[model samples]
Target: MVRTACRPRWSAVVGKPFSAFPREVNEMIEQFFGPSAANGSTWFAPLSLWEEEGNFFVDVDLPGVAADAVEITVEKSQLKVAAERKAPEGERQYQHQERTFGRVERTLVLPESADPDSIEAELKDGVLHVKFGKRAEAQPKKIAVKST
Candidate 1:
C-alpha cells in the first residue's frame, strides 16, 4: 500500500502554511494583544541590484506608489530609496489581503567605484530604475602592447 502526505486547504490561502500567517495578519494580532504594538511594523520595497559594464543598476518594485512620492538620496557611500503607498480612502472590509501599504524604504551600500554624483533614477510602470555610473579611474582601459 502507498500513502501520500495531506495538507490543509488554508495552507495555500496566503501562499504560506496555515501555521504561519502574513506579516499584516501578525501585526493585526499584535495590535489586538497590545504588547508589541508600540514596536511598529516595517515595510520594505522589493528591489534587485546588479552590476554591468562598470555601472551599477537597481530596480525597485513600488506598486501602487506615485512617482512624486519617491525620494532618492546618496550620502556617505549609501544609497537610500524611500517612498510611501497610502491606503485607500473610506472604510471597507477585505475578504483576503496580502498587499501592504505604508512607508517603504530600501538602502544599499555603494561600492567605491560608484560615482554618487552620477547617479540617476526614474520611476516607470511602478518600477524605480536607478543607475550608478563608475568613476573614470574605476573603468577599464585597454593597454596596447608594442614590441621592444
Candidate 2:
C-alpha cells in the first residue's frame, strides 16, 4: 500500500477515486486534508463526475458552505473547484462531527472540444452547478448536398 503525507496548504486538494484520478488530485487532496487524510477516512465518496445528452454536469454537495466561499476555475482544459466550510463560531465542542469541511476541490480535464468560452457556474441551495458547452467541432455535425 502506498502512503502519503500532506499538510500545510491543505486548501488546494481535490479528492476523487484514484483509478479515475490523476496525480494532481492526490496533491490537491493532500494539500487540503493534510498528512492525516490519506487513510480514506478524511473523505467519503469524493466528488462525482457525470454526463448526459452531450452535456457534462458536475454536482457537488456542499451543505455547510456558502456561495461566496467557493472558488471555481477553468485552465488549460482542466476545471478546478474548491471551497471551505467552517463551523459556526462560539467554541462548540462536538462529540462527533462528520461533514466534509475545511476545503474540498474537484478537477476535471474537459474534452478537447469543450467550449471554455461558453461556460457557466453558479451555487444554489448548497449545490454548485458548473456548466459548459462542447465545441461545435466536438459535436457531430450533419451535411447534405444536392445530386443531379
Candidate 3:
C-alpha cells in the first residue's frame, strides 16, 4: 500500500481560512486613497436638552459643520435639525478616514406646552444652542374658605 501526501490547508497570519479569504487581500492591497460621497453618514455630535425658568434649551456639538450648512425648524411640537458639510479642498489620503460629511437631520420632540414662536437658535465655535419659552401650564389649585 502507498500513502499519498495531503497538502495542508493553511490560513493567513490572522488565522482565516485560505480559501475563504479573497484574492485581493493576498495582493499588495492598494495603499492609495480617494474621496467618496459622505452625503449620508451617522451623526456623532453630542446634544443636550434642559429646561429652566419656563424655557427649554437645546445644545448640540457640530465641530466641522458650518452654520450655513445647518437648518433648524419646528413642526407639530417637534424640532428638526439638519447639517451638511463638504469635503476639504486639498488632497486627503486616508487609510481609515472616519469623518462624517452628510446631511444629518435630528428630530427633537417637545412638550405640548412648548412656545414655538419664541424659539431662538445660535451657533458659536461649533456649538449650536437653541432656546424656547414654554407655554403657560394650568396646575392644580386649592381654595380655602372661612366660617360664614
Candidate 4:
C-alpha cells in the first residue's frame, strides 16, 4: 500500500510467515521518521573521502550553495567543514521540500600523516573539492637493492 504524508497505509504479506511483521513495522516506523529527518531539519551535505597519490581528497556536495557560505578549518588531526544553504526567495506553491537548508557541520578525523598546514579547498560547479597533502614520511618510498 502507498502512504501519504498525513495518512500511512499498511499491508500484510500473506505468502510468507513473519514477513508481514517486519515489513509492516518498518513501513510504520518510516512514516514518522523518514530520510528527511535522518539528520534532523538541518541536513548535512554528502561528502566522499579518498586518498590519491600523496594527497587526501574530500569532495562535498553543495549544489545551489554559495562558496562564501562555506567554512573550512583544520585542527590537529581533525578537519571541519561547515556550510549553510538558504531556500530561494519568493516562492509560490510547494509540493515537496526535500532540499535542506540552514547550518550544517561535518568534522572528519584525519590521519596522523596528514599535514594540517598543507590543506586546500575549492568550490566548483556545486562541488567542494578539498585536498590534504600527506607528510613526506607518510608517502610511499622506493628503495634500490644492489647485488652482493
Give the winner by lDDT: 4
Candidates 1 and 3 compared: the better one by lDDT is 1
Per-residue lDDT value at 37 in model 2 = 66
Candidate 3's TM-score reads 0.62
Best-to-worst order by lDDT is 4, 1, 3, 2
Question: Which one wins by lDDT: 3 or 4?
Answer: 4
Candidate 3: give the clashing pairs: none
The residue-by-residue lDDT of candidate 1 on 1-148, one tens digit each, is 1222454323445554554455446545555664234334344567888999789999998988999899999989999898988889999787666556777667888888899999889999999999989999999899999998
What TM-score, over all chains together, does every model reach? 0.69, 0.65, 0.62, 0.68
lDDT of 2 by residue, 16-42 (tens): 334334445665666677633653333
Global lDDT for candidate 3?
Answer: 0.69
Q: Is candidate 2 or candidate 4 better by lDDT?
A: 4
Decide which is better by TM-score, 2 or 4: 4
User: Candidate 2, after superposition: displacement of residue 54 in Å?
Assistant: 3.3
What is the Å distance of residue 66 in model 1 from its true position? 0.7
Winning model by TM-score: 1
